[model samples]
Target: MTQHPTKTPQFFLTSPSVCPYLPDQQERKVFTHLVGDRAPELNDLLTQGGFRRSANIAYRPACETCRACVSVRILAEEFAPSKNQKRVLKRNSDLVGTLYPAEPSSEQYDLFRDYLLARHAHGGMAEMSVLDYAMMVEDSFVDTRVIEYRRRGPDSFLTGEGEGELVAVALTDEMSDGLSMVYSFYDPKQEDRSLGTYLILDHVRRAREAGKPHVYLGYWVKGSRKMAYKIRFQPQEHLMPAGWERYQPD
Candidate 1:
């Protein structure tokens, strides 16, 4: 009989780069590769420790002087959508979300490109080619899935899928505790629908239905207006210096 030893993950630090969330600030990250059979377990552990996944890498902010990038997770079991969020849900009620294997489609790429151009035209992912997009969706080694949102067709009730044009797509990782939204993109033309808020609301419903406790919303940076949306999902816990504690804004 032969015995094998478990390998420990290796972590690396990134060089400082311009912080996208805050002006006149630099950002650094501590990251590790998430690969092999241990990927799912590793993902669960690292995510709970405040790391976020990109491709097969798990990373968390490691700023030397700033600790503003706080990790947030919604308490799905106790979440109550506010009036505006409820309106977002009602507005998107006609759409149906179907979970699919994490495989990229041309349709998804088209929507992704449109989203980048309209929303992040000068950001890092603006020049991403089709191959890059494919890698983003298909390079995962853990329990990942793609949820596509579209209009509910007549037969949607039977199949639990949607029909017509693809409205939005979410690349998600199903961890032991909750769902982690890796990335999502939608039709920029449908801005009136408030798809971004709708997406998180839908995830809250999903996490509760599946008996999951949290919906990891990644880093919520203080002073970043873009991140203000994350704080709205109340009764959430923030990963603090003392550990996960219910957030109470001062």
Candidate 2:
């Protein structure tokens, strides 16, 4: 019998780039590749330690002077939708989200392009081609799923799938503890429906139903208006320097 030694992951630091979440600030990250037979286990452990997965890489902020990117996870078991969130749920009640294997489709790409054009026209992913989008959805070594949102069909209950055009899409990773929302986008024309909030609310419901304790929401960067939506889903825990601690916003 041959015994193999466990391999330690090698991490590398990214070059400083202008912070996407903060003005006049630079951001750096330390990342490791999440590959091989240990990918799932490694993803779970790294995610618990504040790293977020992109493709097959696990990364966390490693800025030199700023410590604003705080990892957040919703306590799904104890979460209750607020009045506004409840309204969002009600507004999106006609829609159904069906979980599918992490495979990219032309329909999904169309929706993705529309979302980027309308919401993040000048952002990093604005120029992403179909191939890049495919890699984003398909290049994974961990447990990943794609949830597509669409209008409820007359036979939806029988098929467990919605009908018509794809209104929204969510790329998620199922970890040992909870679901991690990697990236999500929706029809910018349906802004009034608040599909973004509905997605998170639905995931919370899912996590509770599945007996999961928390739903990882990546990072909540302070002072970033884009990230402000995250803190609304309380009672969540923030990964502070002292470790994961409950956060109660006043």
Candidate 3:
């Protein structure tokens, strides 16, 4: 019998760039390709160590002077939605989210473009082309899925499929322990619905129904207004030097 040797993933460090979440700060990332036969397992291990997946790459902030980016995961089973979150859920009750295999569609790209233009016009992904969007959605090696939210039709209960126009979409990774929301976008026109918060609430529900323990919300940078909403999901655990510890917000 022949034994196969274990292969180690090659990690690389990115050059410093302007930090998108904070002003007057430089950001660097330590990343590795999540590919090959061991990609899923590697992804789980790295994610536990504070890495987040983007397509086929797993990266974590490696800023030399900033320790603000903290990995966060909601304790789904213990999560109790606040009044505001409940209101968000009620607002989106007419919408239904259906999970689909990791595949790209022109509809998804259109919404993504509009979202970037409206909310993150100067962000790094603002200029992503259709091909770039496709790569972002489909170029993953681990267990990934795209959740599409649309208006519920009369027959939706029977078919488990949403009808009407696409309102939002979330690119998610199914992990051994829970689901990781890699990226999410919604129709900018429906800002009043607070679709972003609805998406997170939906994921928490999904994780609970699936008997998953956590729902990874990526990095929450302290003092970053844009990331402050992440802290709203309470009973969450943050990756600390001693391992994941319960976060106590002030």
lDDT by residue (1-250, candidate 2, tens digit) is 1122327788999999999988899999999988777889999999999999988788999999999999999999999899999999999999999999999999999999999999899999999999998988888888899999999999999998999989999999998999999999999999899988999999999989999999999999888999999999989999988989999898
Listing every candidate in turn, what is its Cα RMSD in Å to the true structure after a full C-alpha superposition?
3.3, 3.3, 3.4
- Tens-digit lDDT track of model 3 for 157-249: 998989989999999999899999999999999988999999999999999999999999999989999999999999999999999999998
Task: Give the clashing pairs for model 1.
Answer: none
Global Cα lDDT for candidate 1: 0.92
Model 1: per-residue Cα lDDT over 1-250, one tens digit each? 1122327888889999999998888999999888877989999999999999998888999998889999999999999999999999999999999999999999999999999999999999999999999989999888999999999999999999999999999999998999999999899999889999999999999999999999999999888988998999988999998889999977
The RMSD (Cα, Å) of candidate 3 is 3.4
Query: TM-score for model 3?
Result: 0.97
Q: What's each prediction's clash count?
A: 0, 0, 0
**Candidate 1, position 212, lDDT:** 98
**Looking at candidate 1, what is the lDDT of residue 44?**
98
